[model samples]
Target: MLNIMELQQILPQEYPFLLIDRVLELDEGKRIVAIKNVTANEHFFVGHFPGLPVMPGVLILEAMAQTAIVLYAKTKHVDKNMVRYYFAKAEIKFKAPVVPGDVLQIEVEAEKMLSTGGILKAVASVEGKTVAESVIGFSVKNIREDKT
Candidate 1:
């Protein structure tokens, strides 16, 4: 299992933006299982819904993407600083409202990988109930500090 700190080595997301909390399982290019602990203290809740806050569906997708990145990094053996992964597409379905105190389980499976692009299918669930699922298409590109 990889903790948040270790995950930071594979992903560029920071606080308030880092959606994945921990990685429960990882199999390089094949599959991964991650966790995201949604808390009422999340900043988005302030506007997402003032009183009855619900975890935004987009964030759930972000968590899934992060997990995919970890898998990619491990498989490619590339340092996070040397490369970056961008979401090419995301087809997501929100099935339930994710509230604070919910522990979201994110599972991702790599469907295909190529030099120019790749595809990953993922799902987020809470208490055995699916909250969201998405198939994300992404590409990997070299990172140049001065070119961004």
Candidate 2:
């Protein structure tokens, strides 16, 4: 159970880039459930479309990736103080359109763990309708003490 502020502290993303709004459920090394409140006021709506604003499909996938990254970070014991999860790859399919004023429910289930990263299955839904789903991959990298 984590709120936006709490999530920000744990997740590296900030402001507009941080996609997930709240973490509803988390089972270490298993699954995670999160939510993102898409609003008409979002910055993307201005450029994506002026008359009919639509939440970009890529953003939906990013939301799922964020959800899975957080799950991996928490479960793998990757020290947040020293490590960050990098967006490696994603195989996703979109079933419906997500629009402004929709609360996206993102659910991720851990499928496999690699030596340097892991894979996860994620889904985003709106009002019981599946909007998007994906198999996401991410890698953990520790902060470099010296960058030369």
Candidate 3:
């Protein structure tokens, strides 16, 4: 439902840090499904392993978090330009290694929402096999107010 440009408008991450490539589906306040096209040229692959490159587990979780933030933005109708989303917590499990050339599909659902933030359940997979899953939380702050 959202393309890379649209995602860039909603998310704060830039190149090399923006993990999501495109969003395939989103149910406003409830859930989202996105994709990350991992490639051999990713910078992380250089040091993560010399001969064997694995997409970092943390980045997979980050993709999930970014997906959730998009849903939160849509659900709350908050302006990304006016606010910042902070990843607050996560409890994750890695089921497999994610390597280059794998299209990582991320799925996230809203578990609970508070005035300042919310909790979400997220999962990432490659070709239908789950690579990582987590329950993550985040908080949003208005940037304009913070400057005061």
Candidate 4:
């Protein structure tokens, strides 16, 4: 189980963008489970819908990607700060709307581990019901900071 502080260290995202609130379970090279607590105060909720706010689909996908990055980082023993993780592709489907006060549980399982990254299967659920699911792909590459 990873707390928010540890997640912040592993993820490059910060407030308003950092979606995964906590990691419930992690199995290196295999799978991960995380959660995002959606609230009415989320910045996107203001514009996504003034009266009927729904969590954006893209953000949901991003949450899945973030969770996968944690798995990839652990499996490959890479320093997350030294590398960049990219969302390569996704075959996603939304089954329901995610609203404020919902605890979005995200689960990702490795489907195919690659040399540079890997393919993963992801799902987001609310109260034990699936709200979204996807097959996501990612790639990791070293971040070259100017040393000269």
Candidate 5:
């Protein structure tokens, strides 16, 4: 399992953008399972809905995508600071609304890898039931460091 600090070392996202709280399971290039502790205090709840706050579907997808990125990075043995994994495409489905205080468990599996990127199958669940699922795609590129 990975905590926030360790996640920060591997993930490029920070603060509100950093969705997944911890990685519970990992299989290098094959698969990964992560968690997102959704709470009422989340900034998005303020504007997402005042009376009936719900975690946005897109953010759920993003969480799944981010988890997939970690799998991609680990499989390729590339430092996250040196390589950028972009969200290239996704075919997603939202089966339920994720609400406050819900513990979202995201699982990602590598479907295939190409020269330019790879395809991933991800699912988000709450209490063992799937809330969202997707076939996600990612494109990896080496960062061109600026000499400043």
Candidate 6:
């Protein structure tokens, strides 16, 4: 089990943008199970819908991607300073709406890897119900120099 602080050390994500809360299980680059606490205070709820707020499908995918990043970091043995990940492809299926106060269970598994890219499949669930699933391709490269 990886706590929030431990996960923080493995990934370069910060508050508001940090989607993963805790890692329940990990196999050092092969697979991971993580959790995200969805709350009413999430900024997206303000515009996503005024009254019937549902967590955006895109954001759920983002949470999955964030979990994948942790798996990649652990598997590649690359420190946060050395590498950055970009989303190359994502095929997502959203099966249900995620509301506030739900605990999302995110699971990611590495499907394959080569020198330049890798594929990961992930699923998000609430109360044992699958909410979304995605197969994401990621490419790793050095952090870009242009911040501006």
| Candidates' C-alpha lDDT | 0.87, 0.86, 0.91, 0.90, 0.88, 0.88
lDDT of 4 by residue, 11-33 (tens): 88888799999999999889999
Candidate whose TM-score is highest: 3
lDDT of 1 by residue, 46-132 (tens): 998888999888888888888888888878877877776778799999999999999999999999977555899998999999989
Writing each residue's lDDT as its tens digit, candidate 3 over 44-114 gives 99999999999988899889988998889888987878888878799999999999999999999998977
Please give the RMSD of candidate 5 to the true structure.
Answer: 2.4
* Candidate 2 local lDDT, 20-88, one digit each (tens): 999999998899999999998998899888798989999898889888877887787666677767777
Against the true structure, what is each candidate's TM-score? 0.93, 0.92, 0.95, 0.94, 0.93, 0.91
> Candidate 5, 145: how far from true, in Å?
8.9
Residue 137 CA displacement from its true place in model 5, Å: 0.8
Alpha carbon lDDT at 93, candidate 5: 89
Off by over 4 Å in 1: 144-148
Clashing pairs in 4: none
Q: After superposition, how far is residue 43 of candidate 4 from its true place, in Å?
A: 0.6
Q: Which window of ten consecutive residues has the lowest lDDT sum in model 5?
A: 139-148
Task: Mark the regions of model 2 whose C-alpha exceeds 4 Å error after superposition.
Answer: 145-148
**Stretches of model 3 off by over 4 angstroms after superposition:** none
Q: In model 5, what are the clashing residue pairs, if there are any?
A: none
